[model samples]
Target: MAGYRPAVLVGRWGEEAQLQEERVRDFMRRRERGELLIQKIKSLQESLLQKTELSVCKDGCVHFGDTVLLLNPAPAEPGPGACGSLALAVPLEDSSAYSAAPLRAPCGVSAVQGVDPVGRNTFHVLSVDGTAVDEPIRFGQKFGLGTTGGFSAQMFYLASDHKSFLRFATKSHLQQVFLTEERSYLTCWKAAFWDPQLRLEHEGFPVPANSKIIITHCHTNRSLAVPRNFWTRSYFGKEYEVVCHTYLDSHKAEEDKNCWEIVTGDPSNRDGSMCDRPDPQPGGVRKELCEEA
Candidate 1:
């Protein structure tokens, strides 16, 4: 757990905004009128957790241009339901929030402030040449999350001013990973399979389809990971933070926190049991799942 400290170690960045009295009045008016509604989704289930999955991929190895889910099962976050495990997602779903929900405008993602957390968001795979072919993406090769004519639903992708790419920057020992509006060298990421049992890295092989895999930022050479304690309050409530820092304590280059299963084809249903709490009794999480973090 040496490298798994909760704090990001990176400085928080954002732009300034004016919180006008009118905006406060508007929020108060909305709160008084019962218009500030909170949305909730059913928590984590072993079978594909998403309801609106796009049919871009088939039941085989993950391919370039396939729309996929980055299903993360680490942290074992405590939430009502379905939100138990984390999934890589952006802050606001769309730009309509800034105009429609004026009180949130000052927090920064749109104009200057921002956030990246775990939620149910889909990403597309692409090679550097802009090819979204039916070919399987292999390990140790250059690929990226966002591409031309590919599906992207994150707030950054949906907005007009920002670029849609997952990028990282290393400041001192901390690697600050984030979504950027730039499509430069920093957006490149390569997948390396981690053996489930042995927790070892596999290179130069075809990445398995709909299986456990870890993505590394090409520029920082850090694995995409979720912090156990770091989090932020979002429109979707409290969500854990997403980072790209390789843990020294991880088994060989594969840590449970860094593991993300690819959601290729139909992620609609499963046995309908939550992974963390199978039994409905108090303190009923299975032994293996409740292992100390």
Candidate 2:
């Protein structure tokens, strides 16, 4: 055999080792970059905390990481933008409860169930993200408002001086309602219904056992549906000549026996003069007091 063959060097092994080393180096660099970004964000948040007056609110208007509240009488439904169907209110005062924190209300149904202001004559917390104002927002304070229907309305602050809140008026605040050229009507009457539980009767209304009558919104025009949960405890005489109607089943017709005969195909021609006054109850009938007939 000839003298030992010259040793041959294959560079494949060396190349693979270099490639693995490069990958390890790249991974370390990326991790360091992520750490730097996290630190920068932390710094920015700390800086903002020093400037915002949101830390001074003590009346529950400013809660950190909690949903605030808004009060509006509009019916709940899906709509455009951050509020969805719920309303919005700006905070006016800084109290100890809201002091030293940032506030946020997440979008979607959380905005409704978690943040919406619901109740009558109570203070409502409105969460916000920004610098707090100088004084506590209270009754008579004014806020700029915009609506989805291109309608601009004023949101007056009617809350008590004790705490931050949005006030809902039990009395009518509408000075006048200007309708279009369409025929409209406003009628008031007592609501009647049967209640197995009879809870509503305790609240108000005269209900006989096994009777299936209840207050509901009904429209004469086939194309339109009645507003949801429409009820008014206050009843007054007809001021406008707009016409609307309500229907009574055979059972309800038998309750009064004589008052149920007032229906016509066109609700406008029906005799509302015979419509009885609304019963004195806490929450009265399913009456259409303000609507376009």
Give candidate 1's error at residue 122 in angstroms: 1.1
Which has the greatest lDDT? 1
- Candidate 1, 167-233: lDDT as tens digits: 2222222355555555667678877766545334556667876467777777667787665455555
lDDT of 2 at 287: 47
lDDT of 2 by residue, 203-262 (tens): 432222112232221111110111212222211111111112232345433121111111
- Give the per-residue Cα lDDT of candidate 2 at 27: 73
- TM-score of model 2 (CA atoms): 0.20
